[model samples]
Target chain A: MHVLIIGAAGMVGRKLLDRIAHEDGVLGGEVTRLTLVDVVEPTAPGPLDAITRSLALDLSDAGAAAQLIAERPDIIFHLAAIVSGEAEADFEKGYRVNLDGTRALFDAIRAEGLKEPYRPRVIFASSVAVFGAPFPEKIGDEFFTTPLTSYGTQKAIAELLLADYSRRGIFDGIGIRLPTICVRPGKPNKAASGFFSNILREPLAGQEAVLPVEEDVLHWFASPRSAAGFFVHAATLDLEKVGLRRNLTMPGLSATVRDEIAALERVAGAKAVRLIRREPDETIRRIVAGWPRDFDARRAAELGFKAETRFDDIIRAHIEDELGGKI
Target chain B: MHVLIIGAAGMVGRKLLDRIAHEDGVLGGEVTRLTLVDVVEPTAPGPLDAITRSLALDLSDAGAAAQLIAERPDIIFHLAAIVSGEAEADFEKGYRVNLDGTRALFDAIRAEGLKEPYRPRVIFASSVAVFGAPFPEKIGDEFFTTPLTSYGTQKAIAELLLADYSRRGIFDGIGIRLPTICVRPGKPNKAASGFFSNILREPLAGQEAVLPVEEDVLHWFASPRSAAGFFVHAATLDLEKVGLRRNLTMPGLSATVRDEIAALERVAGAKAVRLIRREPDETIRRIVAGWPRDFDARRAAELGFKAETRFDDIIRAHIEDELGGKI
Candidate 1:
C-alpha cells in the first residue's frame, strides 16, 4: 500500500510520518511506500525501505492538486491548513488557502475518478474550533457547527464537502475533528491555545511559563502521540460502517487549566505548578472563551478510535517522548 | 429606494416583482428604481413610472456579480438557485452556480467597502432543504444542517457566508429558509415536491392530480403569498436585532398529505378531492421521504413574519391571490 501525507511538515504530520516509517507492516497485510507532500519539502522520516517519495508544492495551486491526485496513492492524509489566528487575521488569504485550496484538492480527486477498481482512503484533519460559544454540556456528534472564527468556518465547510464528495464515490473518506494537542512539542507557538501546553511543558522542565487565562478555564485535549494514533486508526478502518456521514469527532479528555496545573504537580511537583505565572491577557481570554470545553465523541469511540484517559498521562507521555524520561 | 432582484424571472421572483411594482409608493415609502437580473430577461411589471432595468446574464459569470455590486442598490433580493432535483443530477453546475456565484456576489460587496456607512440590505432565499433526515418532531433555530442533497448543502454554505459577511459589516444580510410553497400557480414543475402543490392545486382547479405518496407523509409548507411576504420582511428588517446569526426559518403550516386533501375538501368542496387520483410513484416517495416534516419557527414569528395557522387557510389564500378568490 502506498500512502501520501499532505502538510507533512507540521508537528502532528511529522509524528504520523514517524509512525508509518517504523510500522511499515499493515494490520494483517503488507505495506510498501509512503509519500509526503507539503507547501515546504518535508524532511525524510529515516531510511525506511517502505518509504519512497517526498515533494513540496502548495496544494491550492490550480493544477498542482490534479498533479498530486494523478499519483493515485492508496491513502491520502490532508493536514494542510492556515491556523486559527492567521486565518482570522488575513481574511482573503485565509479563505483562499483554507476554503478554495481544500475544495481544489477535492475537485482534483473527483476529476480523476478513483482509477476504476481501487479507491484511495482520504483522511482529513479537522479541528474542534468548528464548535463555538454557547456550547452544550457536552457537544454531541449531532450538534450544529456555528464556528466563531474564519478558521473554524472553513473547516466546517470542508467537512461538508468531504462528506458530499465521499458520497459521490470519488474516494473513501473520513474527517477527524481533533482536539487541541496538549504538551505540543518544540518552542511555544503563537497560537492562543499554546498556553495550555506551554504552561505544562515549560513548568515540567523547570522553566517559567505564562498563564494568560484563569486556572478555571476548561478545554478539550489529546496528546501528539494519541493524535497520530487516531489518524492511523482512521486511515485503516473499514469505511462502509461510517455510512454517508463520514465525519466524526475524535475522542478527547476534557480538562480545566487548574486540572492541567494539578496534572503538572502530579507528574513533576508543586514546585513546577508554582512556576506558572498568572498574567491574564484579555486577547487570549476572549479567543479561548469561544471554544468548546468538551465534546461527546461517541461516534469516534464507537468506531474504535482511542485517546489518553488521564491528563497526567498525557503530560508524562510528552516528557517521556521529548525529554527521554528525564521528568 | 433602489431595489435589485437577481433571478427576477423566476416564478416567486416574478410574483415579488409584481407585488413590489404595484406597491411602489406604499410599503416602501416611495421607490425610485428597480434592477432586474436573470439568465433570461425578465418582463417589466406593467408600465411602472419607476426606472426599471432588465439584464439577461448569468450572475455566476466572473465579472457580472462585481458589476451588479457596483450599482449598490438600497435592497438586493437574491432569489436565484438551481432547484434540488436538478442540483442533485448535475453536481458541478449546482455548486458553481449556487455556491460560487453566491460567494462571488458577497466578496464583490465586501470589496466595495461601506461607502460612507451605506450598506445595502441583502435578502437571500434559502430553503428548508438545509435540514435533512432523522428530523426532530419540530426543527428549531439551532438544528444542525445535515443536508441530504447537494442543493441543501449549497444553501447551508451560502447562509454561513451571509452571516460572516454581515458580521464583518460588509452588508446587512439575511437568509430566509423558505418552506415548500404550496398551491403553486401555473403548470407543475419537475420538482419532486411539486406533487405537494400539484395534488391540491390541480384538483381545486377541476383538473386531474396525482397523489404519489401515502397520506401520512407529512411535510412543512408556506403559501407563495407568505414566501413573498418573507422576502419583503427580510429586506426591511433591522438586522442588528438579528445579531450574528442572519439566517432564519420562515413561519409555515405543517401538515400531512391527508391534512392537505382534507383542507382542499373543506375549502373547494369534496368535488376537488374527487379530482385527486391515488397513484404512488417510488421516485417521488424517495425524494419526499428525506424532507423536513415540521419546524418551530418561533424566532421568525417573534420578528413578525406571519403564516397560515390552518392548511385550509393556506390553500384559500393561494386561491384568493392567484385566481380571484374562486376555486
Candidate 2:
C-alpha cells in the first residue's frame, strides 16, 4: 500500500513516520511507497528512505492539492495546520492555510475520484481546541464544538467536511481529535500551553523552567507515542462501526500541575522537581483556565484506542521516547 | 438603516419583506433603503417599493457578494441556499452556492470593513438538518452537529464561519436553525419533507394530498410566519446575550402526523380532512425516519424568538396569513 503524509515535517508527523518505519505490521499492511509533503521538504527515516519521496508544497495554492492527489495513495494522513496563536493573530493567513488548504485537499480527492472509481483512507489530525470555554465537568462524545479560536474553528469545519465526503464515498475519512502532547520535544516556545511541556521537559533535562500557573491547575494530555498510535489505529479500524460521526476525541490523561511534580519526583528525583521555578504569568493562567480539563472520551476508548492512565506513565513514556530511555 | 435580503424571492424572505412593510418598529429602526437580491429578480412590496432596489444576482457568481457589500447595508438577511434534495443531487453546485457563496459574502464584508469601519447584523437562515439520526429524546443547545446530507453539511460549515466571523467583529452574525416549516405556502413539490406541509396545506385548500408516513411519525416544525419572525428577532436581538455560540435551533412544535390531522380537522372541519389521502411511501418513510424528531430549543425561546406552541396554531397561521383569515 502507498501512504501519503502531509505536514510530514511537523513534530507529530515525524513521530508517525518513525513509528511506521520502526514497527512492523503497525499499519496492518506493507507500505510499498511513502510520499512526504510539507511547506518545507521533509527528510525520511533511514529505514524507509529508499521508498520515500519528499516534496515541498503549499496545499492552499491553486492546483497543488490536485498534483498530490493524482498519485492516489491508499492512506493519507493530513496533519498540517496553522497553530492557535498564529491563526488568531493573522486572520487571513490562518483561514488561507487552515481552512482553504484543507478544503483544497478534500476537493482534489473528489475531483480525482470523478475520473474513475477511487476511494482512499483519509486520517485527519484534529485538536481538543474544537471545543471552547464554560465546558461541562467532563465533555462527552456528544458535546458541541464552539471553538474559541480561529484554528479550532478551521479544524471543526474540516471534520464536518471529512464526515460529509466520507459519507458520499469520496474518501473513507477519520478525524482524530488529539489531546495536548505533553513533554513536547525541542526548545521552549512562547505558546501559553508551552509551559505545560516546558516545566516537565526542561526540568528533566537539568534546566530551570518557569511555572506559569498554579499547581492546582489541571489540563488534558497524551504522550507523542500515543498520538502516533492513534493515527495507526484509525487507519486500520472498521469505519462501519464509527457510523456517520467520523470525528473521535482520542483518550487522554487529565492531570494537574501538582501531579506532574509528583511524577517528576518519582521518576527523576526531587532535584528535577526543584528545577521548576515559580513565576506565575496572569495572562497565561487566565488563558489556560478556559481550556478543557477533562473529557469522557468513551468512543475512542471503546474503539480500542489507549492512553496513559497515570501522569507517572506519561512522564515515563516521554522519557523513554525523547530521552532515549535514560532519564 | 439599510437592509439587504440575499434571497428576497424565497418564501421566508418574501414574508420578511411583507412584515417589514406592514409592521412598524419591527426592525427597531427606520429603513432608509432596502436591497433585494435573488437568482431571479424579486418584486418589492408596494409600501417599500420607492426605497427598494431589486436585483437579479447569484451570490455564488464572482464579484456579486463584493458588489453587495460595497453598499454596506446596515442589516443583511442571508436566506439563500440550494435546498436539500438539489444539494444532494448536484454536489459541485451545492458547495459552490451554499459553502463558497456564503464565504464569499463574509469575506466581502470583511474587505469592506478594511476600507472603512462597517459592521452589519447578518441573519443567516440555517436549518435543523445540521443534526442527524439517533438523537436523544430532545436535542439540546450543546449537541454536536453531525449532518446527514450535503445541504446540512454546508449549513453547518456556514454556521461555524458565522460564529468565527462574529467573534472577530467582522459582522454581528446569528444562525437561525429553522425547523421543518409546516403549512409552507407552495405547490406540492418532490422534496421528501414536502408532505409535512402538503398534507395540511392541500387539505385546507379543498384539494387532495397524500400522507406518506405513518400516523405516529413525529417531526419538528414551525410556521412560515415563525421563520420570518425568527429572522427579524435575530436582526434586532442583543447578541451580547448569545455570547460565543452564535448559532441557535429556533423553537418549534413537535407533533405527529395524527396530531397534524386532528389539528386540520379542528381548523377546517372533517370535510377538509377528508381531502387527505394515505399513500404510505416506503422510500419517504425511510427517509423521514432518519430526520430529527424534536429539540429542546430553550436558548432561542429565552432570546424572545417565538413559535406556535400547538399544531392548531400552525394551521391557523397558514389560514390567517395565506387564506385571507377565512377557513
Q: Which stretches of candidate 1 lie over 4 Å from their true place?
A: A26-29, A114-118, B24-29, B47-49, B114-118
Reference contacts reproduced by model 1:
0.32
lDDT of each: 0.85, 0.94
Quality of candidate 2's docking, in CAPRI categories? high
lDDT of 2 by residue, A1-327 (tens): 999999999999999999999997788899999999999999999999999999999999999999999999999999999999999999989999999999999999999999988899999999999999989999999999999999999999999999999999999999999999997999999999999999899998999999989999989999998999999999899999998899999999999999989998999999998899999899999999889999999999999899999988888888898999986
Give the poorly placed runs of model 2, Cα more than 4 Å off: none
Q: Across residues A1-327, which tens digit of lDDT does each residue of candidate 1 receive?
A: 777788999999988877776675542235576677888888866655335677888877879888888877778889999998899888988898889988998888887774444467889999988777788989988887778788888988888888877877777889999999998998988889999999998887888999999888989999999999988898879898888778888999999998998888888889999999999999999988878999889989999999998998899889888899996
User: On a 0 to 1 TM-score scale, where does candidate 2 land against the true structure?
Assistant: 0.99
Q: For every model in order, what is the number of clashing pairs? A: 0, 0
Q: How high is the TM-score of chain B in model 2?
A: 0.99
